[model samples]
Target: MTRFSANLGFLWQDRPLPDAIRAAKAAGFDAVECHWPYATAPGEVVAALAETGLPILGLNTRRGDIEAGENGLSALVGREDEARAAIDEALAYAAHVKAANVHVMAGFAQGQAAHRRFVAALRYACDQEAKRGISILIEPLNHYDAPGYFLATTDQAAEIIAEVGAPNLKLMFDCYHVQLMEGDLTHRLERLRPIIGHIQFAGVPDRGPPDAGEVSYAHVFKAIERLGYKAPLGAEYKPGGPTDDTLAWMAAYRP
Candidate 1:
């Protein structure tokens, strides 16, 4: 059976992170993940997860200086210090919360210099967090949603993972971005199965609930199961209305 993880970042934006964790549990989600939870005290999040018994799958590194239009820091050529700081902060927070993975964000950058910087930062992260048994994730953002983003395709992410040469380093295969950037989801999933650390999905183009989308998640879910991916897939979609109102799709996946 396919299990699901509510992405607290978009699922319950109106509530506190702790409250969102509770909501995900109540909503029958198997687990939960978030974008940036730095503002919320790790103790609060830890307490909520303890109360609900829902494991947090992962959380993202802070997007540096949002006001300056910087999406992430690790890939920018001149921001090595800031990038390492973000990585350190994320790994520490993940450890405190008992989370399993950290999605290292690669900011808006391009060129060989950016590539080298990103690889070095990822190496630092993988080395630092390996002792804790935490996996480091890198996701490819679609060009339409994240222009100039350094990592923009599965091929690129796979190549970088190879270059970094870390067992704990893996790819975050978000279906929405992959479908948008490179069609053929099933084949890609098969080809990249070994390196896939996590998977996420949303309605393409709209980024809404998965019930209505260009890609059929029902079929995709079957493919994922066949690929032997046992983790709960992340439901990282916008609700369009109250998140509760958008959960009708969950019934189809439940017993």
Candidate 2:
């Protein structure tokens, strides 16, 4: 059965982290994925997951120095130490919370320097996480929403993943970003299925809930099923209205 992971980052912002976990379970989500869960106590998050019997599928590495305007550190030239430290911290937290994946944010970077740093960061994280049975994910944010983001296309991500050549390294395929960056979602989904560790979706352009989107997720979901993907599809979208009001799509998507 297909399952969905509520992205607490964009959903349930009105509440605390634990409360958001409970809200996701109540909303019929089988699992939850958060942007950065470090602010709340790990014990509290663990307790919530235990109570709800839902897995925390994944969380992200901290976006580096928000106050300094660094979206992330992993790909920044001359920040290898900071990037590795971030990876270590994220891996430790993921281990504590029993999370299966960690999305290593690439930040705003460009050219060869950034790419080299990104690969080095990933290699270090993959080696560190493999022993714990965890996977490392890299996502490509579309240029429209994230202008200077280091990664912006599936082909680019695939190339980097190939270069890294780590068993634990994989792509975080976001359908909305993919559609926005390059249309033909189904073909890309099928073509890139091997290297993809997790999949996410949202309404294109607006970044809203999945129900009203240029891409027909009905067919997309069918293609995912046909391709035999085993992981849950991450719902990482901003709610157009109340989060609850935006979930009519769940009734049909839930197992």
Candidate 3:
């Protein structure tokens, strides 16, 4: 059976983070994930997880200076200090909340210099999280939604993962981004299965509920299960309206 995780960043925007966790539980999601829970106390998140008995799968490192159009810090040439600080902060928070993975954001950058910086940052993050049993994930964002984003393709991410050479370093295969950037989901899933730590999805073009998407999630979920990915897939989509009204897609995949 396929399981799903509610991405609280989009699913329950109106509620408090802790309340959102409870809502995900009531919605029949098997697990939960978030964007940045830094503002909310880690203790509150941990308590909610305990109450619901649902694992928090992953969270992202701080996206530095959003006002300045900065999406991430890890790959910026001169921001090594700030990048490591974000990584440390994320790992510390993950430790407190017992999150299984941290998606280290590689900011808008290009060329060999950016590549070198991103690899170095991932090495540092992977080393720090290894003893804690936490994995480090890198994701490729589509150009339309995240123009100039450093990580922009699965092939690029896979190459970086190979260069970093950390056992815990993995790829976050977000289907919405991948479909926009590179089609052929099932083949890519098969080839990248070894290093994929987490997977996410939303409707193409609209980024809404999976039930009304260009991509058929029903078929995609079967491919995921066949590939032996037992972890709950992340539902990282915009709700379009009230989140509850968009969850009819979940009924078809629930165990």
Candidate 4:
């Protein structure tokens, strides 16, 4: 069966994280994911999840100094300690929330120095989280949307994962970014299946609802199921209007 997770990061931005979890549950999401949830108390998040009976799929490491325009901490060349701390913080929060995965964000950086830092951070993260049984994920953002980001392609991420050589490390494959950056979505999915830990989607270019996207989600979802992907697909898109208004597409794929 194909399951969906409401991305509380973009959806229900008007509400608090706990309230957003409730909103996702009310809207019939099978699971929930968030971009960052450090501001919300883990107990409150746990309470919401308990009440709603919806599991949190995952959460992301902090993007350092957002006011300074830093997108993440992991790959920045001189910030190894800060990046490792961010990983620890994310893992700690995920432990409290019982989230299965944590995305270690690779902030804006480039070249060999940035790659070395990213691999080192992942090594530390993987070693620490192995005891907790939580998976560490790396996602490649599209350059158009995330200019100058260090990780900008699926192949780059795959190579990093291989170089890191951690069993707990995996890929967070976002279909929206993949479609925009590299159009061979199904082929990439198949090739990266062994390392893919999660999947997400939104409309290409517009970043809206998935049903009207340039890529056909119907075929994509079917391919995912046929490939034996058991994880819930994260709906990581901006709503066209109110969050609820963009959910008509859910009726078709979500039971």
Badly placed stretches (over 4 Å) of model 2 are: none
lDDT of each: 0.96, 0.91, 0.95, 0.92
lDDT of 3 by residue, 1-255 (tens): 999999999998999999999999999999999999999999999999999999999999999998998999999999999999999999999999999999999999999999999999999999999878899999999999999999999999999999999999999999999999999999999999999999999999789988886899889999999999999999999997788888888997664
Q: Estimate each model's TM-score.
A: 0.99, 0.97, 0.99, 0.98
RMSD value for candidate 3:
0.7
Q: What is the lDDT of candidate 3?
A: 0.95
Assess candidate 1 and give its lDDT. Answer: 0.96
Tens-place lDDT per residue, model 1, 72-125, is 999999899999999999999999999999999999999999999999999999
lDDT of 2 by residue, 2-79 (tens): 789999999999999999999999999989999999999999999999999999989999998898778889999988
From the highest lDDT down, the ranking of the candidates is 1, 3, 4, 2
Q: Which segments of model 1 are wrong by more than 4 Å?
A: none
- Candidate 4's clash total is 0
State the lDDT at 251 in candidate 4: 89
* Model with the higher lDDT, candidate 3 or 4: 3
